[model samples]
Target: MIIYTPPKPAESIPLIDLGPSFSEDLAARKAVAWEIHKTARDTGFFYIANHGVPQTLMDGQLDLAREFFDLPLEEKIKVDASRSSCTRGYETPGLQTLDDGSPPDLKEGFLIGVDLDDDHPYVKDGVPNCGANQWPEQPENFRTRYEAYVDEMFRVGRHLMGLIALSLELPEDYFAQGLKEPLFNSRLLKYGPQPVDAAFNQIGAGAHTDWGMITLLLQDDVGGLEVENAAGEWISAPPIPGTFIINLGEMVRLLTNGLYHANMHRVLNNHSGRNRYSVPTFFDPNYFYEVRCAPTCMPENGKPDYPATTVGGHIAEMYRKTYGLAA
Candidate 1:
């Protein structure tokens, strides 16, 4: 698990077309894998185009997000995350602090995970974060639309994971084996525009690396997302119609022995008068699955920079710190 940081990060993220992988031609699939390999190692961030997800469905998610945020503060708090044992439901602004000394993020969000029933084995077993969703009654179709989108996104994520496996020179199904009952989640966020005189640190999100395998983000036209380069410069990642921004996470970096980049990133306060909306889906392995450096990714020395840990444990520790629950 040798760590190899790039000397300089790319100024622009690679735009990859996944259409080739769907073909039966082996060469086409290999070509896609090569492209993914380069961009993943260079920046750990890229734009995916020609993905199977319908544009209409993507638009529908944004509509639902705006509508949900428009509800009165009282209605939004009805299913607040504080009421749930897992990380689901509405999250108020200034509640999540990404950096130790940075001001709480100036954004509001809603989190959703695999919708399980009380009778589900995980819920029955008292698994952390395996609870039913709390849907608001007013937005009658909100739950349905969100769940539909989640299913579609999950499908795409699994497909990408297979491609990632191929890129790593492993069997295509390698990751699928550990993804049974994955610990994934999706978030709907709204960042209000900041005042001209707002403090420099009043950001929508502070600099931090994602804790899971990967993240797929769909952003609105109003841009604010920025990725930090190796030189520590912030690169703006504006919204690109019909494209989802994909980035590797810490888990991928750990598993790849640092062949992939889990680059740090943050969001600036929305400067546009209209609220900025985004949907980011996190893809992870099963909660109890143990992760380690892959044989193909390890160097000759075979020394791991990170120790082995369960997916659930990694997430719990991150949550404890971010939520101020850690001593």
Candidate 2:
């Protein structure tokens, strides 16, 4: 019984480790995928185990994340989002701007990527990954390490798509063609020790569904993520030390005809005076993918009223809004 509860902190829900999910045998793999699919379709969220993300790598990333944020304010401000495309740059506290009518987010972040090109329609400025990257000169290996992580994440993210397709009873390569030359955006983020608000809602990020296809998240020891369930109920999402939290994003939900929902989630900034850092490598459809209904996803007579849209076009609009450029 998936009840539609109001939005708030979750009481309790069984957390399952994602280990033993990937099997060499077809039947075994399908079974694991289905279990995850059922949970995702039912709650739009879940804890993951056997996700194959290394603890050392995640810990190292966290340490470097702290180092990156601890740099002098002047150094941090050099690559501000205002100076790049795709909003890649450093954003300090009170810099968060979202559609939700909440106070400033209690966090800061550094954004980067390399998807920009003169021919790539998404690029508006020199920044790649939607804009230009803010490379740190002091940390000689920062870019290399982050890029390595992103590559590994992308590798894992692609596998997840095949599993998702299998769970939906679709072809294993269902999402492959469109993913060639895809526009990928990975976020290196940090949260915590933020200003308090009178309303008592200490928002690190707003309550919103990810606008992409899927998100692979790497979180540190401190946890404060919450996702809205089927009944619109909030469920606590904590750190499991060595797993990547994967969630179906809105585009995937739409592509699957809502079989998997893009859950609404947010970060709560109440960490006993400790900071939280999260890194997510978003796996998105290549811009050219025509995000339309498949026979398996939608019946001939059950097509959605909305017109079909390209994967890139829809994201471009969302990107504009996320960066306050949308009209």
Taking every candidate in turn, the Cα RMSD to the unseen true structure, in Å, is 3.7, 3.9
TM-score of 2: 0.87
Per-candidate TM-score against the hidden true structure: 0.94, 0.87
Residue ranges of candidate 1 with Cα displaced over 4 Å: 1-8, 196-200
Q: Can you write out model 1's per-residue Cα lDDT over 1-327, one digit (the tens) per residue?
A: 979974566898889999998888877888898899998887789999988999999999998999999999999999998887776799999889897788788889999887788898888998766777778775767888898998888788988998998899988889887776667889999999986766568789888999899899999999999998666778988899999999998888889988898998888876668889999999888888888998898778878887878787788788888887641
Clash list (residue pairs), candidate 1:
none
Residues 1-327, candidate 2, lDDT per residue (tens digit)? 999976643344335554555666788767767876777676666566676767677788777788888789888877777776556778777576443667666668886655355565555532223544777764459888887787777777777777778888888788888766655677667877554543455478878888778887888878888878777778788787677788877787777777777878888776478888888777877766787665577867886644677766787777666655741
Off by over 4 Å in 2: 1-22, 117-129, 197-202
